[model samples]
Target: MRIAIVGGGISGLVAAYRLRTRLGADADIVVLDRAERLGGILYTGDVGGEPLDLGAEAFVGRRPEVPALLGELGLTDQLVTPAGRRPLVWAGGAAHPLPPRTLMGIPSDAETMRGLVDDDTLDRIAAEPDRALTWYPDGDQDVYSLVADRFGAQVAERSVDPLLGGVYAGSSRSIGVRAALPGLAAALDAGAPSLTHAVAAALPPPSDAPVFGGIRDGYRVLLDALADAAAARFVTATPATRLARASRGWVLDPLGLVDAVVLATPAPVTARLLRYVAPKAADAAAGIELSSSVVVALSLPQDTALPDNSGILVATGESLRAKAFTLSSRKWPHLAERETALVRASFGKFGDEAALSWSDADLIAAATEDLATVTGAVIDPVEAIVQRWPGGLAQYAVGHVDRIAEIESATAELDGIELAGAYLHGVGVPACVASGETAARRIAESLSAPAKS
Candidate 1:
């Protein structure tokens, strides 16, 4: 049987690997990507003669998918965790400790937001539990609307927006409560008295495990390993233009007829691929917007006096051009051994695409300037590398859950087609890994079924 997996991102790569394992030696699988290289946004570039991830550098370790995948690939030795350091939030012209016991920066109580917000905002938060909250069951809205209305705009801007910006590359205004914070939404739907109570109920139980994980070298190691294991024909710098029903199965452009196909491209690309085969799914997917981002990696002198914290997140309305700074040398213990200290400054957001057009020199200059402002340290970079990811992240806007449900329902009727990507369920590495494997399993099962007489 022949299978085509479109898009060479992590989701598509993982799907190809899973399909290889399930189908064994005889099955033919081809992986196609429009880019010259694979890994999609998970690109690793060099800085100061050492490999550093220019895209996502870490994954949520609390999830099992990443660790489990590493073990399967015998690359568990590459799995590394953070140094157990807390990240600070830069707001009000200073850096403050990131609030504790909060779900994505929505504090369970007023005290968690004490230093970050003003006294008036603190008073508002303290009294929030007593206010009557109006939340309809199974309803949805932007996170900013809910947090700002219930706890004052300061909480949403200073505390919540920074964290959301780091995750979605978009503000709370572009993310929805139901999809971004399902537990909190469930708590509200279950009739929680106030936002405070809902946040309290939704918070996960505390644990000592590291909250995030990364590869010791870079994501390139995993990408290389997955590619080798999948053993599929890799087609780079080529895009699959069309997909349609065929006599026996399906015809994927450039790849010809295949027993099955998995479209692991981004939301917009996936929507286009499904336009004729599944119009409803395509409509829902087309409504899902994307956000762009840029990462500027700076190699600094090892003796630079950066903060002891893991990283710094910028609050909304900050004058700095950068949104966040990941002190790679401080965040990852494995990177501390490098010759020069490493820092990754992120730029752009959902509606802000200006950084994407900036020259590498300009991006590096902005990163250097912003790092100085946030860290209050001498800014001198030994070397720098800039990577741009336009329309890289999917915005989980209001009614996102309903849209995903609609997309899935409409595509479920197809016999030999599957969809997987960061847009459907989540934007994290673990979520993408799971999506790919799930898609592979479903397609393998359908193809393995006996034909009706």
Candidate 2:
């Protein structure tokens, strides 16, 4: 069997690796990436002698797949936790620590909310006289509005929206939290009562495994490891322009060719290829618009006095240096220089595209200025690094899941066709890996299914 994997990002790489693990070269595999690089969003750069994460900075503990996979790959020693005390919810000129006993940002006791909580909002949420709940009445609802309705518009506007943009690099108005946060969504639907109470019962206990870990060297280490383990050959810089169906299976040309192709690129690119194969599916795929974001890393002076392990998230109306900044040195000291502080700040989400339009020097200056106001730090950065990812984040709109299911079902009739990437399942790195693994498993199992009887 000859399998062609499209898009050499994390998803494609993982699928190829997993196929090799299960099939042991029973099939010929090749990975094609348009860019000359791997680890699409796992980019890391060196700024002023310090390693900086240009893409995602940290992984949450609740997601165990990442840590477990790292351990399996012999990367146990690379685990590093952000030194920040706790992520803050910045809103209405105040930054409030997430109340204790809350799960998934849902406060167990709404009355305990500080600073930004309002009596009217609390009354609206707590009043259950005319309350009615069902299995998420609508399968398609914006996650932002749901949070705003249940947790107060302040929480949604200040905390949830920015965090979603931070995590997904997209707009929250179109995201469906139920799919993004399935566990919490399920608990809510199960009648745990109140977003706060439901969340407590929803999340499971923590794991002994490091919640999150990257290679001590960097994300490239993991990508390189998987590349070496895959049976698929990799062709970098060979962009597949079009994918046409063949009488035998499928001929992927400069466009795409192969028995089956696993597209792991961004949603828009994926849609373009899928259009010729399945038009309806292409529309669904294209609907998931990707958002662009920019990350700026600054190295502060040695004399800078900063809170130890404290990272701050700016409220919506906060100074517009950028959306948020993480005290890199304080959060992950292992990656920082002792004499100087390192900070990673992000600017540019849906409506904030103009933020990245500025020159690197100006953007860094702006970011530093914002940090000065939030942290009261008075020092110029020694070195600065800025990275921009265009259309990298996937937006999950209403009926997204159904559209995906339909796509999967639509492509099944066409043998040697498989879809694997963040757009299909979850969008996080761990989930990306899982999505790849699952797609590969499906491909492998069908191959061994006794010729479909």
Give the top-scoring candidate (lDDT): 1
Please provide, for model 1 over 181-223, each residue's C-alpha lDDT reduced to its tens digit, 9 standing for 90 to 100.
9999999999999999999899999999899999988999999
lDDT of 2 at 363: 87
| All models, RMSD in angstroms | 0.8, 2.9
- Give the whole-model CA lDDT for all candidates, comma-separated: 0.94, 0.71
lDDT of 2 at 194: 61
Candidate 2 Cα outliers beyond 4 Å, as residue runs = 25-27, 118-138, 191-197, 203-212, 255-257, 336-339, 448-453
Q: Model 1 reaches what TM-score against the true structure?
A: 0.99
TM-score of each: 0.99, 0.89
